[model samples]
Target: MGTKPKTRFGVIFEGAKRELFSVRELDNGDLSIFFKAPPFYDFLDGRSEKTLEHRYSFHRSLNSTPPAITLMRTVALEGGQIIRTSQLRWRAGESFSTMVFARACPTLRPEHYIMKERPKDTVILLYPIDIGRTTLFYHVVVTDTSLDPVIFRRSGLWVTSETFGHFKLVVLSGFFLILPFHRGFVSHAMTSKMRVDGQEIGADLPPIDLGNVSPERLLIDIGRMTTLLAEGLAERHISYIREQRYAERFVTETRQLLSLRPVPTPPDLPRR
Candidate 1:
């Protein structure tokens, strides 16, 4: 029997105005693109300093915010064919200036077809749209699943702030996980005795807590870690807090600590 053949696809991008733009694929199968539009500072009509400060703080707190762009778009290709549903869109308002944002080529693994032994010819064209219109252009080529060549292309003008706040959360969570682990070498080992239908099937192994810690302390630490993890997951629409067993334990422990009652100290008694 013969093996099935792979498909191919094509794509193209055209900017309404000449601007900076780039595209990259994330680890989680999401495609991301970043671009900048003309500076819109002049359009800040009667904008208060407080409002500006708030905007700046929000952007700063979330390091994943991309620079302002007049317009941005991303398209995904599988086996050389563009997947329409995977298209992403963004656009900024008309107030920003025309300085093009810096273009970036973050590390991305192009789909396997792009790296095939006999890769198909692909072209990406980018240029200015017009003098008054600050637009960028893109052209991509791909091969379809039926081994037919097809083109996927689109163009648009820049729009307002397009922030990747959710991506930032993922990065923050990763940083948190690494920080404590880097501070000291801590190891957690778990042993579970298996039983069939409630019958004892094995002897209990000795408990070994690699880190010098008590149950209360361990639970507290775990709770804090889970809190951060939960925050990150929630930002990414991952309901691990409710679905994962460990995450549930962390939530329970954290709530317990927050609601803990005061413990009374025993009175000293004189001995005869």
Candidate 2:
């Protein structure tokens, strides 16, 4: 008897099941998230590009009104033997819960995947992937028994949290949020008591009063707030050396595997 050969799907699933990101905390109370480019999904966007490195920052939202973190994605690309960088901003909504928000893996429980009547197609798995010591996250995966890879017809809701708990800030919803006042937040909502999942992480922020607003003197107040943003966090400069090394090693190995696969080029487009 001989062992079965590993398929491309098996290799992908193995790598996908592992922890995919590294994390650390910055001196300025910001969280840093580091991840590698997808091994299987090489063409993240439409181009002959592959990712080299990624530097993500979960910092204070400059907008302030949303009570979300500034999710900045900085990726280094290698295309045509030329290295370039790209950047973008996203928001990780504040939700401070460690329950089903993360860590819902079948390996931990085993009983969850043993349901008799539950449809396999409907089974969605969310596992807690420890990127670093600072925070935890849910890695979404779908149940698949076949060797063929299939796309899961679902989108993810990115609910993130800080070490202590959720932010006690109110995010104004709907069209009213488009208004310029209160940094796009409703003034009354900012001072209102809003709790997330009944967990109060921090003290409520007082109403931000811009006393007798004048356009000329606004720069003074903005300067003070900018200085305040740089204050140190309780856990300053936490490192994720081990996780970082793991992701880097995975990336190197994936690149090796990718080199073995031939990339298709169109006749109209010249190869780089």
lDDT of each: 0.23, 0.27
Q: List candidate 2 stretches off by more than 4 Å.
A: 1-17, 39-46, 61-69, 79-272
Candidate that scores best on lDDT? 2
Residue lDDT tens for model 2, 7-109: 1100012223332234444446564444423421133365445656554444565566544443344545554232222121223342221110012111211
Candidate 1: segments with Cα more than 4 A from true spot: 1-19, 41-272
- lDDT by residue (tens digit), candidate 1, 56-118: 011111122332221122122222322111111112111111111111111112231122222
Q: For candidate 2, what's the RMSD?
A: 22.6
What TM-score should be assigned to candidate 1? 0.17
lDDT, residue 231, model 2: 21
